[model samples]
Target: MNYFLMLSNSHADGVLSWYQTLRLEGRMCDVVLEAEGVKFPAHRTLLACSSDYFWSMFQDYTLESGAHTISLPALSSKGLEQILDFIYTSWIALSPSTLEVTLQAACYLQVTPAVDLCIEYISESIALDNCCFFANIAAHYGLSKAFTVSNSFIARSMCRILVAEQYKAELLELNLDSLQEVLAAEEMPGVKEMALLQLALDWLEYNPQSALQSNALLCRIRYSLVPPDELSRLSAIEPALCTPFIHSVVHKALNYHLQGPLQPLLQSVHTSLRTTNSKILLVGGGPEADRPQNQILAYEPRTRKFRPLSTTLPTKLQHQGVCVVGHFLFVLGGEVVKVDEESEKSAVMTVTDQVWRYDPRFDQWEEMEPLLQKRAQFTCCVVEGVIFAIGGRGQRGEPALSSVEKYTMNAGCWRSGVSLPHPVHGQACATEGTGIYISGGIYGNSPDSSKDVLFLHAFEGDAWQRRASMSIARFGHQMATVRGRIYAFLGMYEPFCDIEYYNPEQDLWTHLKPLLNDRFCYGLMATGGRRVLVFGGRKWQEGQEVCTTNVLEYDTEYDAWREVCKLPGPLCGTQCAIMTIQDPPET
Candidate 1:
């Protein structure tokens, strides 16, 4: 009986084999596809399931009745043959010679899976020689990721591309928007600004009519980021840029030249996008559940949106300390509570030293040496390329800890550092110059034991010393640094609208403008040099408090706050940190 059952199951697994056989033999085909006046046999049900265009055609009974065969007018014969083979076999051949045509056919049929496969192929097949060819196809099919990936290849091989006679000859046909986007990218980190100017001039020489007509494209160039010397060279080459009206822009850029924090001259939409856009990462703090399934979330500043990263922490974590060391993002010690099987409810589980490091450049993660002591509700900071994890209680949340540990990238080990002056947790920490600053934390055993005392630890001194306290007590608050100044945010206590910072120079804490809403325990990150973004947190209203997805962005230079974007759900008491990932590798 078992032998017969095995035979039946094996046959069931190969049930689709009949479709492949029929497609290969051109026998019992219910539909015919005509491309370039040639016919190919296909099974209607298989084609309908594989392609939206075919599905819609089959859905209309009147259309099916009128036509026994359909003409794929936009598809080449080879492309149509490949599509039919994919519908039956779940695979199709792709190569440089046929990749573009195959992708075009798949997109026209709205076959997302095949199109995705084609995109993956394009991403893998990118090289300096064919990057523009791939980019042209990507733009035609609205494949933004493909364009971005290929552009990096083009950017890295830029010197070669600039000199390549083939690319120069084809520059005239390059899409205008694609050229603008590639040139506008602030991603050109160390490639001297002069090279970008040269590329722009090269394009202008080939297409002067468009250059003379469109200043909007010209505005996309990051003129402010360039040095005055480079601009001088540019002016010598392009006289239109130095004309009286445009020369004023050059003067503004050269004078300010993005030298100081107050250098706010360049407000062009292009520069704003290039400079301000970065990804803010969020971890844990999902729906409260028995099992505690938590994943990492990323917020793209360019899109002003939230998206979850593909990888998650080793286990569900809450109140974990996160810090960045160079290209690596480290998730330090945190607490995880799961329901006991006997009680069937949440229970005190464990304080974890489980450490996970993520490298966003490669979208990869690995386990790092765990912390010396398990902790949560702690504050972490990176000073002089070393990570310091300080003061937080163990599981069950009793007597607070004064322990501090340092994680060094070179050593890849955690060693004890000078502990905090006293037991405290839920403090906010940031590094300004060479010192690490801690402000506002809970001193007692519980969350309610909040305090406003502040402290500073200089790696030079290797000691923690008491500093001036905040005007109000806060616990579970956040801190962010902008232009060497530390900004402390309100925690879960009263005066939730106020934000204050300690002045290392004056040794005093001062309040900035109060927030638009009272918030506590939201994910906070500083980006774009002048802006601090706060994510979802709890909100108070009608004498009741509940979790909220509200987000507010504050500008330090302007001393102004405005709504940006919201998280996917309400979150509170969650830990957050900001780190910049290096751009794409030299292709």
Candidate 2:
């Protein structure tokens, strides 16, 4: 093979690069542009060669109509100058500050190259921080490709994105229709009606003049997720709820969500949330040592490979709380340093208030505001955009803590939530429907005691309420939500892979098929909403504890467990989560 890179293109490059010089010299000039208040001279051939839109315009105004002035009124003189400069240079300086104006002019003139380049830049720039603003721009200019890219990013990172200072301004200025569409978009994870209601209330605070136009937006919220206390508190003051029709609809939905309705009036309301795409994430807990492994591995389901990421936690973080909000993984507080096996000094295992977030798009870990209190060995899950950190070991290696706190992704803040009925440590938590289910945790005792209890609760209003318990007693298990069902996979040293399912409607737990062998403390998660991926942890072999490097996959639809890939190295006391990495749309 021969490579002739950039060879003999010198002559062509010279002519194309000097288009501006010739135009300024008035060489073979055929037209003049009176755009806004400034005048620009150009040759018909030069303009035609640069853009099809320009060629079409020139064709209509024949050469016989020589020296004619084309009246360009849509853009300012500066906007037109940027376009002309790009035609000559094949480049433009695009920044967050200048992108919008240039895009407007390019779209107005139907410049395909300019428009496509701008769209590509926007797609590349889409992140949790700027997704909302870019989505609004994409929607306004009818850039469907950009819209899809930005909208999906916004939908996935809705809670985190909303808390951004930039998004606050963008949301207030957004057209009512666009704002409503954002609230109503499908495929949003960990977002409940209460969060949406909070968003709506925030919008009203910013744009109070639009209170009259909010009923249409309010109707889309799932009112049943809002607890009766909060609903009653806000109804007396919130304008949208004050409206008769909207208030009645909300009250009606609230009743249906709280009570058992024989037949429901609302058919379109989504009682269940949109299922998120999944990729397996293996978090903390590796080999025990003074120097520990902070490697966080993510399984690329599409590629069928396990890859270690640089976005590991700030600490060794064993027995930490991990959950997925959109594609971002939030790891709650855990033990910062390792504890000595023989010493058993409580000072060796220091707990931290740190909360970290791993963003797949950026491939980076960011430390958010710390928790209300330092904790370790806690159970956590995202319930409609809130990270609920349930019972765990308190500071100074104390017994299980019944106190719970949740981080609100919407506001970038953490506040106290209702505490669990009993203390819990090393429990498994998962979300289905409107509630978070706690299963098989050891509360204030060793792993053998009270480890098989289960409780279901949600943010009904302000307080925590308990539901029915599971039949089997399990502790030190992993939880994953698969197709709206909560599946519990338990054991590591005592090595048992028996799985169980919790039915919210029937309020019962059913045991599923057992695994190939006994496994314990493994990192278990549901990927692609159909397959359960069990990652590495230790298992007992002939009275010897050894790490299991092999991974297992459980196909829910087929009801089978098969041995899958093996980790490069085995890890124990590790945590795991599922994050769907979004690839940019094909051109």
Candidate 3:
């Protein structure tokens, strides 16, 4: 009896023929054998050989049953033959798509090569999808090119996707403008509400203007679509959503939509009086003074004009601490020197602890109670009518002091408060809430400086904590707060014109636009609203000293700096103070 066996076409026919001969020659064949055009001799002597062979046969049956035959890409006769050979002989070079299919098949069959090919092909085509899926995959694989491509597509399509997808937090990684656009374009009724609520809470946390703008846009859309009664109901559901957008909308609604003569515009005369107009207070030495007594020049906001404040001091002053409380300006300790008649250079002079108060109403100066400790290069901040003096140099600039004292206007006396943890001079101080943040200043003498930024909490009781450090290690830089961000500008370091902005919440520092000229010991004062006035500091050019009369105003809203007015006279380190004066009520 002749028998035949089915095996892969790549197997040698001679080898299988030898096996068949060996099985037939036995007294009883231990293998099942069949030949071409012949049936198996089952009745004569039938035997199952190896279990491995039986399992292999079973897998072939399973694959045939489960195989999904999809149309393959059209190929030449040779290519088709090669593909068939690969299936029958298990040897064929694969294309990208074919490799994906082979990989899927291999995974089903527990084949390693096929699985590897699939991963390779998917990696190469990472930029193929709309980026939502591929971006996630790229992030997993740590493929930078894939990430770049996917990020680009996700940013472009972010607006069109439903807000539900955005809530997944994966979309938060997108740029703020893209998120705003998506929130703005969403037209579904509840979508705007959800978007606004999420964005408003995010704004409260992140407080980016873009997020706030998104909240405003959603509020507008909600008002337009929902009825008045429904609007009230929705706000009741989410009170937080209403509060963030309300401040902006209330002002707009009151000015544009309300009727009747505007009720005489109850112009916040006192608040306005409390607000300072944008003006430059030029502080420097006047040419006529017997000594270099500190003097101030003022610039008008509306007319772009300059006026000299009638107030004058004893001599040319440097490193004075100035703070404004209501309409009264307090000028604290500063160093004064007299020019030597023989040498024509400034010589020994007195460093005074004299606290001088200047009233804008009288245009005069009055000597107040002297500070308990005479210090120069100190920083001052006014909170709740109490002036807090922090960090300065002691008499003769020998001992740097870390002492802090509070001057209460009610008692008309100076009292010791909490001292800073470390010594600092020429520090930038700004008040926020109940806390005062003091940033980058010089601690030790010349050639040895400190770049550390510290935050002192007097309300918390005598503890000074570290906050974010400035980008550049600098001293004699002017610090001011605008819209809740701390700005440090024009220090005496190598790059004298740089400006650094610190965000207290994020504990991060970002560089702002540089100054037009180098400035040292410059004056920086907030003008309320959106403007900050920066004035008089000494500038250097080719070993020659030029006292700067240049006045520059910074607009936070526009992110711009512009030259407002030039001082009439040379002013450097004059006792500089700023006060907001409201025009008197009309009769």
Per-candidate TM equals: 0.53, 0.51, 0.50
* lDDT of every predicted structure (CA atoms): 0.71, 0.70, 0.56
Residue ranges of candidate 2 with Cα displaced over 4 Å = 1-15, 51-53, 60-64, 127-132, 164-166, 187-192, 204-213, 242-245, 260-269, 273-550, 553-587
lDDT of candidate 3 vs native? 0.56
lDDT of model 3 at position 572: 61
Give a tens-digit lDDT track for model 3, residues 1-587.
99998778646555444444554454233222232222222111111121222234335455522322312232233333332333233354565435434433343334443344435545455432234554544455444555555555443343344334443354544444334443434222112233333543454345454544645434433232223344455556654445655645433433422221121122232112222353446555543322455556666667767666556664556666777665566778777666788976556666778887765433456778888888777888887667898888876647678889888765677888888877778777887767788876777565555567787665675678888788787766777888888887777744547787778889888887777667675557777678887766677778866667777888877778998877676666654555543222111
**Pairs clashing in candidate 1?**
none
lDDT of 2 by residue, 247-272 (tens): 89767766654432111222233443
Clashes of each: 0, 13, 11
Tens-digit lDDT string for candidate 1 (350-415): 889888877553355777788998898887887877788889887764777889888766566899
Candidate 2: RMSD over Cα atoms?
13.8
lDDT for model 2, on a 0 to 1 scale?
A: 0.70
